[model samples]
Target: MRIYAHRGASKDAPENTLKAFCLAFSQHADGIEFDVYQHENGIIVFHDRTLRRRANAEGYLLETPWSTLQTLDIGDGERIPTLNETLGVVPTNKWCNIEIKHLVDVKRWVNDVKAALSQSQIAIEHVLVSSFNHHWLKAITDLWPEVKIGALSASYELDCTASAKALNAYSVNIALDAVDKTFVQTVLSEGFNVYVYTVDEPKDMEMLAQWGVTGIFTNVPELAKRVMAKRASAKDAVSDKS
Candidate 1:
């Protein structure tokens, strides 16, 4: 399974900061997942509509100009990074999952992101855009047919197969708590990759791997790597004995 650093090895570094992203890469995560919202000037990396969590400043992000927003120290003097800035710094081989946080301006954000990535010469295959907003995913797929999309869900109210068919999503990201072998089978049966989020426990990672998940978004990529390596070694030993 692919290990994607959730908000860039967020357990060690300030979430959504470039420091976090760089740290994730250093830890050998296959991918990095970061949240994005449209600012007045462009797309910026941040999860909240307000500055309450990461910054000293207070206001809705959309109301604040990019210049003013960039000045605030998210934590440890890490300024909020633009999508372009983050992509530019990250290695081309590493996958980037850009989760769109704003549902209202999803189309605009997708267009801007595509434009920024193209200008930066980053391959589209290296990126997967996702959102909990189904409409946003639909709109994006409609506009850019080739870009891979993932349906984000924290609940099981919607059937995975139906959702994937509806959105034409390459994958589905479900809450870690909601996953099991049956659910994994259901997703895989439909030819869609299943990725679970925010998994930090070693046992849970092992269980998910056994269930045949395609990827995991985690706050601790280093730990995930260690656990996966141990599992691989055990499997190899079993094969040798047989």
Candidate 2:
């Protein structure tokens, strides 16, 4: 299973900052996952409806211009990065999962995201676009059909698999709490990749791997890497016996 850092090794550094992202890569994560929002200045990397929780600032990201938002230091002297800057951090071999956190405008966001990806000069396949707003994903599909998209759902009732198919999503990014053997099998049987989010526990990671999850989003990339290494070694030993 591939391991993606949730907001870039968020457990170690401030979430969604360049430091966190660089730390994620150093910690051996296969990919980096971060949230993005389109504002007047540009597409900026951030999560949450407001900046209060992480940045200790008071303002709606949607209403705030990038200049004003960028001035607020998230942590360790890291300002919020633009989508272009964030994309620059991803190596060609690694994947970048950009989650659309808010929809100021679906069409406009898709255009800006596409532009940023184009500017990054990375292989288009290396980036996976995901969003809880299926509508926005659908718009992305219509506009940038070649880009891989994932349908994100925290609720099992949302029928992520079906919705993913409808949106032409390459994968379904579901909440870890809703994942199980049955759920993973159900989605896999439909020929869609399954990726669960924010997994931090070793037992849970092992279980998800056993359930055939394609990837996991985690806060502790180093820990997940260590756990996966052990899992791989154990599997190899079993195979050798066979």
Candidate 3:
């Protein structure tokens, strides 16, 4: 299974900062996942409706202007990064998962992403656009038909991966609590890649690998890399014995 840096090695640096993203690649993570919110100025890398958690400020991201939002410190003296800046940091060979946290205009969102990706070395196939609001994903697919999409779900729906099927998504980005071996098998049988979120424990990582998960979004990329490396070595040893 692949390992993605959840909010760019967020456990080490501030979530969604360029510093964290750079660190994730240095840690040899397969991909980086981060949230984006579109504002009057442009698209920005950030998470949460409020700035209280990340910036220790008193304002909602939607209510604040980009000019003001840009001035606040995210962490380690790092300011919030633009979508283009974030994309530029990702190597062409690496992967990126851009989770749409807030978007006011669908067309503007597509246009902005187009511009950013055009400048970055990363290919469209290497980018997985995901959002909990399936409507946004549907609209995005209509505008950019070839762009890969991932369906984000926090709940264990009765339909398993109906949302992903609805969008013809590249993968199903699911919460850790809602996943299990049976569920993974069910989704895999339906031909959808299953990628779990925010998995930081080595035991959970090993279990998911056993269940044949596609990938995991983790806060600690270095630790995930270590766990996966050990798993690979074990598999190689077994293969040699056979």
Residue by residue across 1-242, what tens digits does model 3's lDDT show?
99999999989988899999999999999999999999878999888899999999998988898888889998999998999999999997899999999988999999999999999989988999999999999999998989999999988889988898889998888899989888899999999999999899999999999999999999999999999999899999999999
Predictions in order: lDDT: 0.87, 0.87, 0.93
Report residue 214 deviation for candidate 1 (angstroms). 0.4
Residue-level lDDT tens digits of model 1 in 124-218? 88788888888888998998888888989988755657878898889989998777788889899989999999899999999999999999999
Assess candidate 1 and give its TM-score to the true structure: 0.95
The total of clashing pairs for model 3 equals 0
TM-score of each: 0.95, 0.95, 0.97
Quick one: best lDDT, which candidate? 3
Q: Worst ten-residue run, lDDT, model 3?
A: 61-70
Give the better candidate number (2 or 3) by lDDT.
3
Every candidate's CA RMSD:
1.4, 1.5, 1.0
Candidate 3 vs. true structure, TM-score: 0.97
Better of 1 and 3 by lDDT: 3
**Ranked by TM-score, top first:** 3, 1, 2
Off by over 4 Å in 2: 158-160
